[model samples]
Target chain A: MNKRELIRRTAIEIIAEEGYYNTKVQIIAEQAEIAVGTVYNYFSNKEEILNYIFKVEFDKRLDILKRLKVEAISFKEKLNLFLEEHFQELETNPATTSVLVQESQLPRKHSLKAVDDFINELPELLAEMIESAKKKKEIRDVNSSLIANAIFYTIRGMASKVVLNEHYNFDQTKEELMNLLWCGIKN
Target chain B: MNKRELIRRTAIEIIAEEGYYNTKVQIIAEQAEIAVGTVYNYFSNKEEILNYIFKVEFDKRLDILKRLKVEAISFKEKLNLFLEEHFQELETNPATTSVLVQESQLPRKHSLKAVDDFINELPELLAEMIESAKKKKEIRDVNSSLIANAIFYTIRGMASKVVLNEHYNFDQTKEELMNLLWCGIKN
Candidate 1:
């Protein structure tokens, strides 16, 4: 791994182990097996490191969505693929999931611009997919932005459950979520 | 307002103005025009006060739902009433909404039990409504808990948007949300 990736992975592990407030840059530097100054060279402060972690994860999702856009697949297929990948990402890295969920709840202080951009980007991508679906007649006419927000929040709620509830059956929950989104609660 | 109510309202205002971490019990006492000792006489500490803010707000919601249960209305009507009231509450008290949302995101160091109870109770109440709707054939049979959780998260997303975006039209958003929930997204 490059120095930046090395620092980010180390920061995630440390923040996950010790809550973000308790984590310090020095601790991350030690964990990454680098000098504190070297860590600073990569990230100005601890918050930047946290921001970078989110950016990296978000970028991965965005990349998948971008590729899915070119593939010969239905919007439902794209959404299902996205949800599966999202849940799988969290399931594999429970600690990163915890940090992401927890940090998001805190006040927006450090790297506010980066954080805001990342937050906006997710919904924007989802909205684009919804628009694509609408144009292709895969879905009924609706406010794509609102629907996108609803789907985004549902995914978030699922992720929180995955982290907070140890007994949470991810596969079952994912199946139920897909069924609910595709079919909804209408009789 | 009673002394308890006075303190609770004051705490909400203060916490909303300056986030939960920045808020101190003494500041709350001062704002309420009560002695710090008197504040403690009613509550243990700052966290309890924060918990009380959530409990008070949640209790109001629960009470409304309980009453809605006996009313001669369809399940859809009850759900709409609940969402309308929920959105109105946030619109009227944006500050308290801010405190509630921000504090919920923070690490659970204080009043974990109270926080957990509040979180669980909301989805539980929504689940109850879904169950009622299903039994009455007002809505199709689906997993009540999952549906309830989805509704709960959607409302949360809306609340966050209301706080973040000044131009957000509450009535329109509420209308769109009901329509989405009532009719599936399928073409």
Candidate 2:
């Protein structure tokens, strides 16, 4: 891997192992097998590294969601694919999931606005999905942004549960959850 | 107020205003008009103050929930009443909610095990509600603990959205969400 990429990956590993407060720049540099100055060359400070990690993870998740495709066009199929893809990614990367879920508990001394800005872009992306689903008569006609926010929170809630409830096996219930999302909790 | 009560209340006010890290023991003592050492007499340190505040808020919420009389009622009514109680408390004490939510994110340099323990008790309380709902034929006969976890997350997600989303109105969606929970998403 490139030097910059090595630094970033090492930062995530250290943060995961020792947490943000305990993991210093020097520690990360040593762990990454680079000079401390070299680490500072790429990133200004520790907070920046944390923010970069967060953005990368967030962007990666969104990219996965964006790349979700359906060869045969059915709204149900599309939605199921989306759910499966999202959950599978989360299940495989529990460390990333842990960080994402717990990151909010981190101090607000840094640029949360950047994260907020990234999240703001989601409603529009969801608007397109909602418009298509509406045309397909898959979901009820509602305010796209509102529905989008609900959908986002629902998935977020599910992820939070997976992280917090250690013994809660998500695999068995994954299909049921996707089905519930499509058909809803209605009888 | 007594010296201890004054310090505790002032701590909440300061922490709420300036956040935990910014709000120090000296500042809290100044706000409470108590001696700095007097604050120590009441609590060991800043961490103790936080634990005290959490215990106070935790008991307050549980007290409200405990007052809910569910005997001889249909499961639907029981569940509705539980949610109504929760909403009413959360709406009334916005400051406490902020503290409670943010406190969970604070660095665990102190004994925060109490907080997790409190959360651990939720499944038991929720499982009882779920069983009652099942007996009343109000919800699907799924695993009570699983359903409880889902309900817990659903409320937390909705609550977070209410806090973060400026355009989203919880009041308007409250009824619809309740209906969704009661009736599921099926047509």
Candidate 3:
């Protein structure tokens, strides 16, 4: 892995274990086998490193959501596809998923703009999908903005357990979440 | 109100405005117009003051859930009743509601047992409700424990908006959350 990727991977492991507040830049550098100054060259501060992780994750999801938006699929298909992509990542990258769940609320409290923007922007993208599906008369006329946010909340809450539970079957969770969210939009 | 009640209310207001970490015991006592010694007489420290607020709120919901448990209502009816009681309190006590939504995640990091217990136990109580309903065939057969946690997450996420939106129509929010959670448990 490259130096920047190494720093991020090490940071995720430490943050997942000790939490964001308990983590330090020096520790991340030592674990990454790099000089502390090299860590600074990549990230201005500890908060920025966390923000970078969020940005990287957010961009990936944004790309996925954008591609799904014009796939000519039904709303239900879109939801299932989106959730599968999301939960699969939680299974493969459990450490990063743990960081996302544990530190997500911190953005609301601590002004972590990348995390905040990711959480906020995601629902808007989902809302647009809901709105388009309603226009196509493929779904019920529930409040798009509200239901999108609720669906996002469900994903985060269930994903928390997926990370924390060693034997979690994420496919089951994805189905349950999809069923509940589909109810909000289905006629 | 009693001295403890006074401190609780005053702390909620300051914590809501400046956040829990930013607010101090002296600020709460000064705002309450009580001597610092008088404040300490009732609560041991700032952390305890917040815990006391959480305990009071948790007990209220616990009573509501317990009462609903024995009532001969359908699962849907029980959910409506519980949600009405919970959301109505948010309308009347947005400050405390704000504190609950904002500081709730702190317990996982900090040692605030009341808040932790409140969040943890509510799901178990709801899970019991779900299990009972499933046996009677009043609700769909699903993972009761997982769905219960998802329901609580919906309430907290929607309630966060209820506190932040000064002109929020909580009745609508309550209904939206109800519909989504009902979707989870309903056949």
Candidate 4:
């Protein structure tokens, strides 16, 4: 892997275990097998490195959603595919999920710029898709941004559990969530 | 209000405006119109004070949920009544909701014990209700704990918005959410 990519992956692991406040640039450099000076070349400070992590992750999801928007599949198919990708990514990289869910909740002084952007933009992106779905009568007229936000939190709450708990089965989690999103729990 | 309640109210306001790390006991004491030592007499430390806030808030909701369990109402009615109370509380006391949602998300060093309990216990409480509802066949075969967690996050996400925005109508917000929750967005 490239030096910058190596540093990024190393930081995720250390930050996941030690947390952002406890993590140091020197430790990340040593763990990545690079000089601290070289680390500084890629990231201005620890916060910058952390922000880079969120920016990369959020951007990946946004790209996938954007790509799905143009596909011939129904909005339901799009959502299912996106959720599958998102959850599987979290399931495989629990460390990154842990860091993403946790660090984004820090107070402003410690909060990352990208984290704030994700908080604002990810829902908007989803809302856009929901809006289009409503227009096509693919889904009922549920408020777009509101439903988007609900879905966002549901994923976060579930992903947080996936990182800490082992009992969550993949198909089960997705099916239950999809049921609530598509057909409410009202018997 | 009593002296202890005065301190709690003042602390919530200050902590809401300034992030938790930025708020000090002395400031809370000054704002509460009490002596610093007097504040200590009631609470051991700032963390304890924060924990008390979460403990009281979580217990209030738990009480309502427990009370609802014994009522003759269906799980659907029980959930609606509980959500109305929960959202109305947040709407009226935006400051408290702001603190509860934001503070509970802080890292371990800064995390409050009661916040942890609220996060862990609230979902379980809801799961118990869902489990009982399932037994009665009042709801579908959806996983109890899974739906409970989903509802928990959905509330958190929506409550997070209520604190920051003023455009959300009480009826609109509740209706949209109850619709997605009671009867999902499927056309």
Candidate 5:
């Protein structure tokens, strides 16, 4: 991995173990096997490192979603693919997922705006997908942004359950969520 | 009005303004116009103050839901009444709502377990409502816990939107959500 990625992975491990409030930049530097000054070369402080971690992960997901948007697949297929990939990513990186989910809820400090920007991108991407699906008549004419926000929070809530409750089965939960979104709760 | 309530209100103001990590016990004591020792007399520390804030707010909602459960109202009506009150509470106390929503996402710190317990109560209450509705054939026979979680997250997502985006209309969004839940999203 590159230096930036190395630093981030190290930070995620530490932050996940010691809550973000307890984590320090020097510790991350030591864990990454880099000098303290070298860490500064990439990230100015601990919050920036945290922000970078979220930004990198979110950017990767955005890239995949953008690519899927152009594919000649039905909206349902696209959504399923996205959900599957999203859950799989979380399952593999529980530590990072924990940090991202928890830290995003922190107060809107000016310092965390970069992280907030990255966090906000998910709903915007979901909104785009909904709008595209609406144009193609694949889904009902609903409020795309509202639906997007709902979908984003649904996934977030599921992720929180998966992380907090050991009994939560990721695959089964994903299938149930898809069914609810596609067919909904009403009989 | 009481001493504990005074401390909690003061903590909410500080925590809401400065975020949880940045707020100190001394500051909360000063704002509450009580001695630091007196603050500890009411609670152990800052975390307890925060937990009390959430517990007080959640208890009120849970009490209403429990009372509604025994009434002769339909499940849909119960659900609508519960949601209307929920949104109205958030609207009237945006600062406390912000703190509750944001702080609940913090890492699983032992100090915050009371807050976590209070936070988990909502989903459990929702699951009870869903299971009851299913028994009465008010809703479909589906995974009650999953649907409960979905509805909880949907409301959470809407709450976050109302708090973050200035243009979001709480009443209209609540209506859209009720429509989406009552009549499934499928066309």
Candidate 6:
């Protein structure tokens, strides 16, 4: 891996292992087998490291929705694809998931803004999906933003549970949750 | 009001103005027009003050739900009452709502535990509602805990939105959300 990639991966590991507070710059440098000065060359500081990790993960998940085949798809299929892709990632990357869940807990100012920006984009997408579904007369005429938020929150909340619940199989929960959302939205 | 009540109210105002951290015990005591030591007799610490506020608000909302005639009501009515009550509280008490939202963001053990406990009860309560609805044959057979969670997350997500979009009339949105949930669960 390149210097920047190494720094980023190592940073995720440290933060995952020790959390935000205990993961220090010097420690990250040692873990990554790079000098503290080399760490500074690639990124500004710990916050920047965190911001980059969040953006990378956020973009990766957001792309799943954006790149899906939107034309001639059932709403059930659309939702299934959304939840499965999102939850699978959480299962694979528990560290990143934990960070996303707890990152907002910090007293930082920008985390909410970042999360809000992520949330704001969902409604327009849902509106498009709803418009198409309405043309098919598949569901009731409803406020798309509200529907979008409902779906978003359902998955988000379930994702949190998946992260925290060690004994529960999220795959099963995801299937059940997808069924509920589909049953709720479909005509 | 008594000193204890005064401190609780003052703490709410202070938290509303300066956020959870910025609003200190000293500031609350000052606003309550009492000595800082006097505040101690009423609250063991800031966290205790917050817990008290949460229990009071949560129980008050629960009491409202308990008193409603859900037993004799239609499933739609039962769900509508549940959604509207939550939306109305989110509108009326944005300050407490704000604190609760922020608390969910905290990485501290206590904050995480408190949020978990708050959400844990919801699934059981919702499961009860869903069970009743199913026996009435108001909806299809589904996993009550799973469906209840889906419904709960939807409401929680919308409530968070109400807090963020202060001027947005959540009543209409809430109506739409309830309708969606109702549609999803119905035969």
lDDT of 3 at A4: 90
Predicted candidate 6 versus true structure: per-residue lDDT over A46-104, tens digit per residue: 88787777777777767777765364677667768878888888889877888877664
Per-residue alpha-carbon lDDT of model 6 for B1-187, expressed as tens digits?
A: 8887888788887887787767789989888889999999978899888877777767665665565535687877877887778777877887777776666554364463335566787566778878887887989887777777777778777777767765446788787787778877786
Candidate 3 residue lDDT tens string, A53-122: 8888888898889999999889889989999998887789878888887764453455677867977899
A1-187 in candidate 2: lDDT tens per residue?
Answer: 9877888788877777777778899999998888999998988898878777778867765665566432446666666777777778778876666666656557664445546655576555665776677766777655566555555656666667677776666664465455445554212
In model 6, which regions exceed 4 Å deviation?
A: A69-72, A109-113, B65-70, B104-109, B112-114
Q: After superposition, how far is residue B143 of candidate 6 from its true place, in Å?
A: 2.0
List candidate 2 stretches off by more than 4 Å. Answer: A67-75, A101-105, A111-119, A127-137, A141-147, A183-187, B1-4, B67-70, B108-111, B185-187
Which 10 residues in a row give candidate 2 chain B its minimum summed lDDT?
A: B178-187
> Clashes in candidate 2: how many?
5
Per-residue lDDT of B167 in model 4: 62
DockQ scores for all the models shown? 0.38, 0.32, 0.46, 0.57, 0.34, 0.58
Model 3's DockQ score: 0.46
**Model 2, range B27-66, lDDT digits (tens) per residue?**
9988888789999998988888888877776676566445
- Cα error, candidate 4, residue B177 (Å): 1.3
**Winning candidate number (lDDT):** 3
DockQ score, prediction 5: 0.34
Task: Identify the leading candidate in terms of DockQ.
Answer: 6
- Against the reference, the lDDT scores of all candidates come to 0.77, 0.67, 0.83, 0.81, 0.78, 0.75
Per-residue C-alpha lDDT of model 5 across residues A70-107, encoded as one tens digit per residue: 89998898888988998899889889888876664453
Instruction: Evaluate candidate 2 and give its CAPRI docking class based on DockQ.
Output: acceptable
Worst ten-residue run, lDDT, model 5 chain A?
Answer: A104-113
Q: For model 5, name the residue pairs that clash.
A: none
Q: Which residue pairs in candidate 3 collide? A: none
Error of 2 at A109 (Å): 3.1
In terms of lDDT, the poorest run of 10 residues in model 3 chain B is B102-111
lDDT of 5 by residue, B42-81 (tens): 8887777777887888788888888888889888888789
